[model samples]
Target: MAKTLKSWLQILLKLVNSTIGIVGISMIIYSMWMARVWQRHMEGSSDDFFSFSVIWFILTFLGIGITLCAISSFGHIAAHTANTHCLSCYMVAIFLLLLVETTLMADIILNSDWEEDFPEDPTGRFDDFKDFVKSNFNTCQWIGLFMFLAQGCSIVSATFLRTLEKRQARYCESDEDDIAPSLPFLYHPVEPLPCTVADLPGAPSSLYWC
Candidate 1:
């Protein structure tokens, strides 16, 4: 029963790992798209550039790194020897990256620089930009926050599972040792018995003890 339960737990872990890996890949792709959009927007502007672009670029690279790390970690776990330390590191890095993204998003939304020299018309573009900002602030930013939280939870779960597996292995070894006495000579060789009844001439013929 314990073996079956462990097998099912392993399957569940694999499913969770797969789900997280897929999400990580999706985040990387989305980050790339965001980077492209930011780049295009920056190209159209000569003086409106801010530190937010730099932060976004950093986050984009971090997302790619985290995605690759997650894929590699999943492969290692499939092979039965995942590095939890590396996974933890990746999770921390992702959290930091998400924090930067959230900060930049918030900064862009709150600070409105409305001047006559502003490249895009303040009234029209500002309203449109405000709507765009509002949509992103409410949607994509929240998604980022959730992803960050999920990564943290996954890291904790992985650590706990890894420790549990190690403990199980130790317990199995100890249990085998405890049962060794009752199963003495379990690995020893035994002599073979006589093949036929005729080989035992002294035995009772009517009883046919063989």
Candidate 2:
């Protein structure tokens, strides 16, 4: 039963790691595309829809690559017997990576030309193009800042977990090595005591005969 449980757990971890990795990769690709679109739009080119897509693509790819590595490391930790500290490291790394991606998304969504109310132009000379660029820049900047903050939080959490695990391990070891005295009641035997009826104040006469 224990073995079965362990196997199931291993499978579950693998699935989770793989799913996250795939998602991370996809997000990076999408971010890159968005950046390109932004860049194209800014250059008055109809081929691109956004002017900041290049920057977005670069940042996203870097963040995603780190995230993927972290996830892979987590899978290794989950599948094998490793120090809890190592697992904690993997968790922190993955968290930071995800945080970056989230921040980028938030920035793009917030800064995009969603509010420009400008008509789309095939020739890139639309009056709304300037507004669109300004909006996108603001959104991207905010998103980058948010991503940094999220990564910081992830690092902090991971550090806390790591410290806790280390402390727990130390406590366990101390208990094993320390020869503390046990309580007397805990050491007492369960057998009944041998006693005479005469020793009891409430003993009956028939008990004394026995």
Candidate 3:
């Protein structure tokens, strides 16, 4: 019963890891593509406030996200195989991903300086930007938040799975030890079969063959 439960838990972890990784990769690709489009739009502008470095920064974060997603496969493999070193590596990957995502969320949630620029625009740029974001980019932010939650879940699941692996190893060892005492009797050498009374030596008219 314990083995069955462990098997199910491992399967659940694999599914969680795979689903999150695929979704994360797709999100990174979509975000990077959008960043490129924004960069092209900004490149045609005369404003000096728009910086290509900002786009590059965004791209860097997205690239990190992609790398994290790629490494998630290793986590799944480690969990399924119950490899302690591999699980440690997997935990590190998950931790790094969580760190990056938390940093991103913090950046978005704490930066209030953009409001200062809202009052200086004469060409309705600020209003247009807000409108565009409300209509489109808002969903992207929510998706990023969801990614944070998913990565958090991966961290937790991987941790519990690691513990489960250790418990399973101990259980197996204990099971083997419990059955070890009976092994000698179970595999003891066999003796020859007993002969019938007619096979007795020096018995006349015995029916036994040589």
Candidate 4:
């Protein structure tokens, strides 16, 4: 199976999904660390004004990480199930995710004051993420390219393979049905040939046997 294109594609999808899931887990861990840090800040301060901002900050990170993890999980499920409907659903999810990402990219590239479009971050994670991207632009670009290609190519090929396999299965079943009727005819017993003069050489002549 690994020798074929489909098996290698499935392997690639699994690897990509696993990497995305791990990134999501890392994001969740970072959010947890932020929450811990903010806990100390809240305990030290007497103002209640910062509570909503802190909660929102935490929830925003959590939501993003959960969405990533969910997408990765769905990819895995679709690969395993090999169901056309599940594959279609996974593709739709990927499309929506890509839409959101594209919007983010557009805003970052086109908007002069994109930062003004969002509320202030209490934990500064967004700023840190932005700085990280800026510092590692090439790395992030390459990673994104790999992810986009892996998901797009693998899913499309998987769907094609699934449909092809289904057709092959139906054709094989029809072939088997067509071959079934001739089984008894092929295996029927054969009758023995009549004895020749060679067998009665000691008792009779070849003319008498004939």
| Every candidate's lDDT | 0.55, 0.55, 0.69, 0.74
* lDDT by residue for model 4 (75-146), tens: 888776666677678777777777787898899889999999988876676777789999999999998887
Top lDDT model: 4
- Backbone Cα, N, C clashes tallied per candidate: 0, 13, 0, 0
All candidates: TM-score: 0.45, 0.37, 0.60, 0.69
Model 4, residue 9: distance off in Å is 3.5
lDDT accuracy of residue 70 in candidate 4? 89
* Winning candidate number (TM-score): 4
In the range 124-162, model 3's lDDT, one tens digit per residue, is 333554687788887967876776676666677777777
Over 1-210, each residue of candidate 1 has an lDDT whose tens digit, in order, gives 655554554555455455556666665775566556556666856644345434434364456657655653653364244344554554465456556757766665576642332343321334444577577877866765665665555555556555566677789999998988868578677887755544455866634333
Question: How far does residue 90 in candidate 3 sit from its true spot (Å)?
Answer: 1.9
**Model 2: CA > 4 A from native:** 1-11, 23-70, 114-175, 178-210
Clashing pairs in model 3, backbone N/Cα/C closer than 3 A: none
RMSD of 2: 14.0
